[model samples]
Structures are given as C-alpha cells and as structure tokens.
Target: MLDINNALEDKLLGFIGAGNMAEAMIRGIIRNQVVQPDQIIASDISVERKEHLSSAFDIRIATDNHSLIDQSSVIFLAVKPQAVPAVLKDISANTGAEKLLISIAAGVPVKTLAAGLPKGPRIVRTMPNTPATVMEGAMAIASDSPARPEDLETVETLFRPIGRTVRIEEKLIDAVTGLSGSGPAYVFMILEALADGGVKMGLPRDVAETLAAQTLMGSAKLFLETRTNPGQLKCMVTSPGGTTISGIHELEKGGLRASLMNAVEAATIRSIELGKA
Candidate 1:
C-alpha cells in the first residue's frame, strides 16, 4: 500500500480539464486541505471557466493543457474521452517518466493512455460517481503495468478523502462504471418515488422529501455500519404480516428487483460498448 501521508502532501497537482467532475475533485481536495490551494493547477479551453477555478480555489490556471502538464508532478486527465487523444499528443513529448498520470475519462483504457503518453509514465485509471460533489462518492481504480505500488497508493489516498475507494483489475472497470458510476441516478429515482408515495399519503412536500431522503440515508448507514447483506437487513426490518411486507409485495408485483438487475446489466454492457467505440 502507498503511504497515505506521502500522497496527501504532494506539492504540485494538475487537473487537465476543469469541468464539473474535475471541479468536484479540486473542491474536495481544497476542503480537506489535502494540499494547499496554491499547490494546485488547472486548465481548460474556456477562459471564463479557468477564471472561475482560479478564483474559487486560489490555484494557477493554464490557458491550455500543456502548460498545466508543465507545472505539475501529478496530472489528472479529466477531459472527455474524445478530447484525451489530442491532449495527450500535445503533452506526451514534455511529460517525463517520473510523473504520475491519473485519468478520470470513462472507457479510455490504460493501453490507450500508455500509447498516447511517453513510454513509462505511471498511469492510474479511476471511475468516480456524480456524488463526488458532496464528497460521498464510491471510486474504483486500476493501474497500468508501469505503475508502481507507491503510485497506486498515491491515487487511493487522493480519492479516500472524497469517499470510499476499492482497488480492482483494469478489466473490471466497466462493471464499476455500471454500478457506482450510474447507481446514483437509480437511487435518486427511488427517492423521488418514495416522496411521491408520501405525498399521496397526505404528507406535505417538504416533509415527504425529508422523510424519503432520511430513509434512504439510514438504510445505507445500516448496511455499511453493520456489514450485513441487504436481504438479511430487510428481513430484520420486515415483521410477519406487516406494512413493510405489504409494500415489498407491491414492489415485487411491479418487478422492481428484476428491473434493477436488468438496469445494471444494461449499463455494464453499454459501458463496454462505449469503450469499444
């Protein structure tokens, strides 16, 4: 394992794209003081966005991607998949083997990144969810052959402050994308339905929303803290011939469980297809 202490103190961190996801990571780093605000650098095509980042985080902004790479030791390739090739081509010549490159772009494989950068640049690929905005995300990371154990540790430490992280093989990244990457939307839909049900039961809008959200949050906490299978937990909550059982029967009749399973399968397959494209 990479020492968490060493990673947290990295002096120079660069973000190649300053979009929403990158912004969230930057914000989390700043909020946690993982590194000083002055230690960070970001780049984007839009002057306005760059200015926003500079002002918000008190970090340097590169008008172009190469300048960002030039100033930092650790680089985050936060650009869209379509933009990765061009950006990498522009910076490959300048990047040395010592720099650690972490990419958040979906479906862009390690081989693709290695082909784009100079030979032997340490590379780490990660899948992070939208909930990263609140520092409650679930992230998964995989490293290329050249990446050292220290490099993997560094990447994990950087993400740990933001949320939970798991290390897995590069091949499993698509499944991580399907589960955590797209899972938040499914949870949101469930919360909305729960709120609607509350409203139908004559609760006020705000009350219904709070109740629904708290229910979800509490259930999540129970599963995490107790480390119990969800089925076991659900059984514990469900008394014989009770309201919970009645609601579960309604959900089963609606094929909710099967639908969710199919949803995850579809997402996993689509993620693979997107990578191929």
Candidate 2:
C-alpha cells in the first residue's frame, strides 16, 4: 500500500469527469488505500454517469463543477480535450492558487489549460494509457512552472499504485501519447495476430488467445525484472537452427520492426496536429 502524504490525506480529491480513466484512478486509489472513498468526489454532466460512479465507487457526486472545485483540493481535469476549455471556464471562478489541477486530457497543454482559467492555480499535465483501467498503465507527467515539487510528488503518489510514472518535459508529452497512450491498441493488435497464428495452426480459439496473452505478459515481466537489453533477450530465445530463430527470421523479413516504428511516428505526428487544432 502507498503511504499517501498527510497533505493529501486531509484533502478531498475531485474528478471533473466520471469517465473510464477517472474511474480507474478512483478504483486504484481506494483499492490501494491511498485515500478513503469518502474523501473523493466526482462531477459529470450526465446524471446517470454521476449516479453510476457514486454507486460503484462509494464516493460523493458533486452536482456541478463549481461545487466540486469549491469542495476539493486536488482536481483531476479528466474531461476530453475538446471539452477542456469550457470546463476550465466553468470552474475558473472557484479554482485558486491553493488548489492543484492535474489534467489527463491528451493533446491539451498546460499553457492552454492555464489560459482558460485564473493565473495562479497550479497545473500538471499527463498522458496515461487505457491500460490504467486494469492498473498496469504507463504514465508521463509534466507540470507548469507555477506547480511546486510537492504538487508533482502528490500526483506521482496518486498514480504510483496504478502503474509506472515518469516525469517528462511538456514538449515530449505528444510523443508519450503516441507511444504509450496509443500503445495498448498496437499491443492488442499484435496479441490478436499472434493468437490468429496459433488458431491457424489448429489450436482452439480460446486456448490460443490465452496462451498468446500469457506469453506477452510473461515476456514483459521478464524484460522489466531483468532490465536486460531486449536484443540480448531475443538472442537468448533464438538458438542456432531453432524454431525461434525461424520465427524471428520471418518477422524480420516481414519488416515488423519498421512497421512498429512507423506506427509510433505516425501517431506522434497526428498528436501534434491534434494539439494545434
């Protein structure tokens, strides 16, 4: 369990959107005992969403953004990128220097977020992936100049239980979005392809999928635990004149490496374009 600092313990955490990512964070925080469920509050435009989240997480549901910001200290700006400007404007009057705003809206910058509100509220921007719903996400955090070190630390503490967290420059957040934010879909595609190969070789669909998923999960665990070069690890698995070598040869011939690189690059470029829009 994470030891949430006293600064956070005494304060209420609020979520501006009761979406998947916000729910994921709420689940992790409560499951990890970072804070009591009662100390959390969420506000959403949909009454059904508010009631559902409140019931599911046993947390409070605020009637509106203004009330939520007024009652909480740490606020998660979890609304969609397109919705951020209006949300900031809606809650701006209630936001103050003492409150901390942590945003997970992809392609939205701290500068843009700050511009929508009063000048003094601290802002921390993040890019987090869908895997966060399962508590195994990769997150990149960056903060505006006004945000203090402890504010950054608070954000890290809130996220640590859900997955790995990396502090990065705001400029690189778009790259992080392409790599990790959109990475789960790429990995899912690869997993599906691997399972399809097994099914083509006569394995049952369910068994093949399970094996493929376990193989991917185990490989990731091994890589993380050993911290060995991936190339070295690949060499370890590919013995002279072995089946693994044959498979690797086919992958290389198929330009698998180049395809993945191009995917990331393309996604990164798109992210930049979206931010501009």
lDDT of each: 0.84, 0.87
Q: Write the per-residue lDDT of candidate 2 for residues 164-210, one digit (tens) a residue.
A: 99998899998998899889999999999999999999999999999
Estimate, for each residue in 1-277, the C-alpha lDDT of model 1 and write its tens digit.
4554465355469899888888888888788777778888898887888899999889988767777777787889998878888888888987878778898887778888888885567888999887776788899997543688888788877898888998888999888887888899999999999999999999998999999999999999999999999999999989999999999999999999999988888888887877666
Error of 2 at 242 (Å): 1.6
Pairs with steric clashes in candidate 2: none
Backbone clashes in each candidate structure, one number apiece? 0, 0
In the predicted model 1, the residue pairs found to clash are none
TM-score of each prediction = 0.93, 0.94
Best by TM-score: 2
